[model samples]
Target: MLTITLAQADGSWENPEQIRGAVAAFVKAHLPGNAAQAHVAVQGPAPGLRFPACRQMRMGFFGYSNPYGNQTVAVTCTTPSAWTIYIPVQLVMNQAVVVAARPLGAGTLLAADDLSIIRRNASNLAGSAVVDPQLAVGQVLRFGVAAGQPILASMLDAPEVVHAGQEITLIAEGDGVRISTIAKAMENGRPGQTILVRNSSSGKVIRGTVDQAGAVLVPF
Candidate 1:
């Protein structure tokens, strides 16, 4: 089993057992298959975690190595009650294997398929309220440093939808007037392109151009 050591960043611990239990629960809920790969070791002073708490979370393959040797990512809680944790999968993996015999290397920009790559890619936050989830593979996600930050992710690419009766600016202005019109299903118009906007109330389809803001404008 891979041993995951949970330590405070500033070196303090309030309750080591509580931290360990939280980590264990998070792993069971998110990564059931990879439970055997984890063995948590808590070492630090009492009253650990001041601004935020931390817990060493792990799953799947638990072997990370580099010139600094093997290191597991710790799920950190910025506050004692906030329910979010920054999962830095790509960053930790890349740093851990930088000078190793086989480097993990940097990955491509996050897209809609790398969710699973972040399940165990976090560091810090064990006793706090932030509960980590099992991310999917090939899923798109965005991240940054700083405590309690949000990492946005999405699986499917959705198209923009436009409703009828809303006033929209048009790109094609023949006689000035700024070409404003009510549109229906014409929300699919491309910028600087002409499209047909059907008025929801009148059921009239007027031709107009899409403005820089993607709004369809039609002059009366």
Candidate 2:
């Protein structure tokens, strides 16, 4: 059996199974003759992470070729008793190494054997949180990500902070005593829309429209 230990090549604390799985894919490509065996180790995992077993029972087949024939097998793993464990296996006429591991004692595997299972279970694998101006990378993806989630490139142009129900005074084109005072009922006011206002002296309520200067226009 060829045993390979997973070491931290990248600074991120990535999922151990994900890293090992990539290596497993590599091994599948270089299988000797028509059969091969591999033992994978993941070291320095957070405490409580369990070792996985080699999958048993033919679950199904994926990625088929007409000339090379089809593969049908189960993907399961044996649990680790201590920090490290071995999974023994036998195979014929196939070059495929797939590793599935969980955090210490995390009993479930990362990706399922079935494509439908992955679609129903796994989150975005190719998505990134970072935003790009040229490419619309930060837009929320439904069922995969949310919409209107702020983007980094547009963050520099975030809307100015404004308060709701705040009173703002604008000099009236008429008498200063009857100056227009608007109470913002909501943020992002629209032009030519009626807004509520209060008379500073008489405490009376009046309706006015937002004008070009972002000020309420009262004709009285």
Candidate 3:
């Protein structure tokens, strides 16, 4: 079992560094793994402001949220003469993430040469980011990304494998029967995207899911 205690932090009087240290310790203790280091930053108010310290200082989360990102936590004295104060904390966690190798323009397709894995402060990463290179390769970017910036999920999109007026094999399944015929695509779409396809025999427009092999799957 892992346990930590900060010395000379008894609640006789509030100490600024101790308060910060206690939060830092709390962040480190709450972190998931040893691969990332948690650096707690207590924001707002003067750290040197003196408050009546109780018998013992304890660290607690401000709410039900996990202690990550920008969060608020309570530093309370849990002994005789209880006093609790809320402090804003930002946990700067360092972890590995995928980043762009160079400045990538909008609509650029992701390739192995254009990406690299790098360790960065997780707090600085916005929203969510792509961790594996395989998950990003062949995907098209919807927006321009700066070099060395984390490749976020919102920044990339799947490229269309089939284009409008393109010829493909249309497979229709119904009543435990399968039929295949050559058809022309009426709209552009990527794998698994539903698009309109025109049957070459009857010229009827129908919607189907585009497969990776450039085949349209339709269920009747």
Candidate 4:
């Protein structure tokens, strides 16, 4: 067991348990996400270590340490004597995140059954994992994911509405005049994405934005 001592103005010693509790509370209050999910383990001062009586005390995180995982807290004493000590802390926070239920191939359209929600250590995650099933469902996978692998936001993409070699209507409007032409898409594109199209009528290549209706809109 570790013991830390703090002295009040009356010369009464503060309980070491209170000091540990205070440090845990301080870390929890500053942690991001749900504080209730965080578990903090604060290591007390070294054995037989003693600090002089202090009328005023302040505590803060030392250096560039993050709020979670292994960290250090600096305790500063002010008043009759001024001193500082570093306390080690361990923090773990579990959060629900989406993961693949089975090995899914690249380009596969995700469905509700393809994903599962599980509690994982947020501090150890490599990237921001998807949390909502609705956000993953109907989305196309950019790369293959193994079973039980956490699904990151970068791994999913919007379904392509226009495919290469598909015939689509290209429309351009300016000065109250609107023109439409049939064109072939040069590449796959999702809604709102710019793609190259070859106009069948003029035999010319043009860039246009794919619309929700699957048509390409050329800027004037």
**Candidate 2 per-residue lDDT over residues 1-220, each given as its tens digit:** 2333344334423454643454345335444432343232223234555443322111212233111222222222222212332222222232222112122111111123211101110012122222223233212212221122222222222222223465655435654456444444344444556666665566766666666556666674
Pitting candidate 1 against candidate 3, the one with the higher TM-score is 3
Runs in model 2 lying further than 4 Å from the true structure? 1-163, 174-188
Candidate 1 stretches greater than 4 Å from native:
1-172, 218-220
| Each model's Cα RMSD | 16.4, 21.3, 4.2, 5.0
- Which of the predicted structures, 1 or 3, would earn the higher lDDT when compared with the native? 3
Best first by lDDT, ranked: 4, 3, 1, 2
Query: lDDT by residue for model 3 over 1-220, one digit each (tens)?
Result: 2123445446567667767776666666676664246777777437556766544677777775454477776877665546777778777778778999999999999999999999878675666778898899999999998999899888888898899989999999999999999999999998989999999998999999998888999998
lDDT of each model, Cα atoms only?
0.37, 0.34, 0.79, 0.81
Candidate 2 achieves a global lDDT of 0.34
Q: Pick the candidate with the highest lDDT.
A: 4
**Candidate 1: residue 3 lDDT (0-100):** 30
Would you estimate the TM-scores of all the predictions? Answer: 0.22, 0.22, 0.73, 0.71
Residue range 1-220, candidate 1, lDDT tens digits:
3333445544443354554455444433333242334343323223533334444433332344221122333544433333322221221211110011121123323333222122332333221111222232232222232222323232211222333445554333555544344446554644555567776566777777565565766555
